[model samples]
Target: MRATVIGAGLAGCEAAWQLAERGVSVTLCEMKPKKYSPAHSYEGFAELICSNSLKASRLESAAGLLKHEMELLGSLLVRVAKENAVEAGGALAVDRKGFSDGVTREILGHPLITVVYDEITEIPEGEVVIATGPLTSDSFAQQIKKLCSSEYLSFYDAAAPIVSFESIDRERVFFAARYGRGDDDYINCPMDKAEYEAFHEALVSAESAPLHEFDQQLKVYEGCMPVEVLAKRGQDAIRYGPLKPVGLTDPRTGRRPWAVVQLRKENRAGTLYNLVGFQTNLKFPEQKRVFSMIPGLEHADFQRYGVMHRNTFLDSPRLLEQDMSLKKDSHIYFAGQITGTEGYMESAAGGILAGINLARKLRGQAPLILPADTMTGALVGYITDETVKDFQPMGSNMGILPPLSERVRDKKKRYGMLAQRAMDSLKAYLQEQGL
Candidate 1:
């Protein structure tokens, strides 16, 4: 069987790879180098426009378990991510360009995968997976809207600013991971009470770039809320959120500061670092002026300013099945952020399921509907749960997984048990299905 996969982002690449791996010829479509989205500038496939971190790499953590599950399911992107990973303490951070280049090579080199450079203006007939990302092009987005026959729910998502490593004032900042987690992989800017208050005032009062008229009624996703919008919530709100100083003591002060701003490595070379949890829609000048107030960034050179953009996703509960295929049309599948499975890995997982189930269907085999206990299955279940009323995009989290039969008092212990159970369940299911 032949399959068409649109958009060569993480999800599209995974979907096309999986389909090709299962003996299906794939026509992978990408508009990049021919066209560009407002947020995407990289000519390579699977570009990481936002923060490069793929969250934590520990199995007990939500992201870790989800990635582990994907690895088990033969995820191509996950494999490439590890090969190009940068030091992120416990998280799986990758060099964006290197990772994208790696994925582009693999996909283009695949024997059964044929690359087509074009902006897909319409949903193609036959088996297809729409993995176009959240910032899908206008004409193609319209095609998706027509296909689903539903209004798209959109929210404003933001990316944090990146700064040069040499620009950071090392005298004012200290290198340390939270609680000494990794190898002191983070550059922390400590703030005293007076400094934090001053920063907070500037952040909340900073002028934001004007949004388009249609985007005036902004619905910010909680996961990627702009720092400025978050600061407006209250004075101490940022301290508790991104700028929290729960861990680490400043070597100069010998005490934990009132607040801290963390800069995580953006690439393997450690030349560029992004403001951790500093997603913002602030005007470029405002961002520079306000962010410079941080102890370590007084002379920081901004490599890239933070930006907010409209991210569109489908109401999957009403439109999609557990297999990520459209409920109205089984042959048509949806994957990635467009299907409302938020995070990078979550979207890739969606693609894996879509590809696997579609391949199985073609071979006249039963679809693999994983149990809810597993992270991937739970995420898939949540997106397709028709009982949901107000559906929003969801990323992988332990809360979404089915609870343990017996609750453990310790959070770490409980998470470990949950991860083990998920792994065991997935193994058994795959074995039973002969997959």
Candidate 2:
């Protein structure tokens, strides 16, 4: 049986690859070049719309553990990311264009996978997985609503801005990553106490763009909030949050700056840089005016200004099965950000699970159920279990996994035990599948 995967974003690409690897003929549909999402520009699969970094790379951190798991599962995205990775201290970052182009080439070159470059206005009949991501188009989204009911979708997300390297005042912006962990990979704009205070006041008082009627109905993902929302909390909120300068010290001063705003390299050429945590919905003009006030961005040229877009999701607890298959339709599965699983890594994990299950069904085999001890399995269980109320999109966190069989008082020790248990279960599962 042929497997159809909708929306060739990160999850879709991963899902299609997994299916193809398992000897399943796959159809991968992407609405790009012909159509583009608000945040997406390149005509490529698994596009990195915002920051290039995929969070931390340490095994102790939840995101790091997820990456490790994906590697063990032979994830295409994770493999390519490692090949094209750029230095970003303890985080796994990549050359955005290289990463996407590599994924596109791999998928398109796959003999068993057929590439379709047009909008899917309606849900196609047959075995299918919807990995459309956060920026799914209106017509297709409406069709999904008709199939799954209106209550299972959402809209309104925000992205950070990108800046041209030529415009930055390099002398003022020191090169360093937080905690001096990685080599000099980040461009940091140091601020004095007075400068930080002034910037904070300006940000809080800055006029924000009026949300469209449709955008007003959507809720912002807590993990990816607009800078304006953060500023509204208080004058010092940003200083403590994105603008915090704890780990960084100015080379000239040999002391930590009062506050710092970091810009990370977005491309292999290092021509473009993205504001590390400056996701915002400020008006374009205001962004120019306010962002220019940074110590090193006095004449910064924006490659892409931060903008707000809608992100839709289902109340997963009420809608999806443990394998990311929809309850109403066994043949139809959902993965990625749309399933209320946040972050690039989390979305990819969902794709892996859905693809495995789809392949199993095609083989006339029972579904592959992931053990709950692992972060991957816990995420699937969290979304599919009916007991959860007020379901929100979640990233892989230690909190989602079950506690250790024996209680450990130290947080680090407890997390280490959890990670160990997860890996043990995943290893056994892989061996059982002959992977």
Question: Positional deviation of 288 in candidate 1, in angstroms?
Answer: 24
Residue pairs with colliding backbones in model 1 are: none
Q: List CA RMSD, all candidates.
A: 12.4, 13.4
- Residue-level lDDT of model 2, residues 49-96, one tens digit each, is 768999888776678888888888778999989888999999999999
Assess every candidate by TM-score. Answer: 0.69, 0.67
Q: Which number leads on TM-score?
A: 1
Off by over 4 Å in 1: 154-309
User: What TM-score, to 2 decimals, does candidate 2 have?
Assistant: 0.67
Candidate 1 lDDT score at position 133: 86
Local distance difference test, per candidate? 0.86, 0.83
lDDT of 2: 0.83
13: Cα error in model 2, Å: 0.3
The pairs that clash in candidate 2 are 154-312, 154-313, 155-311, 156-310, 156-311, 157-309
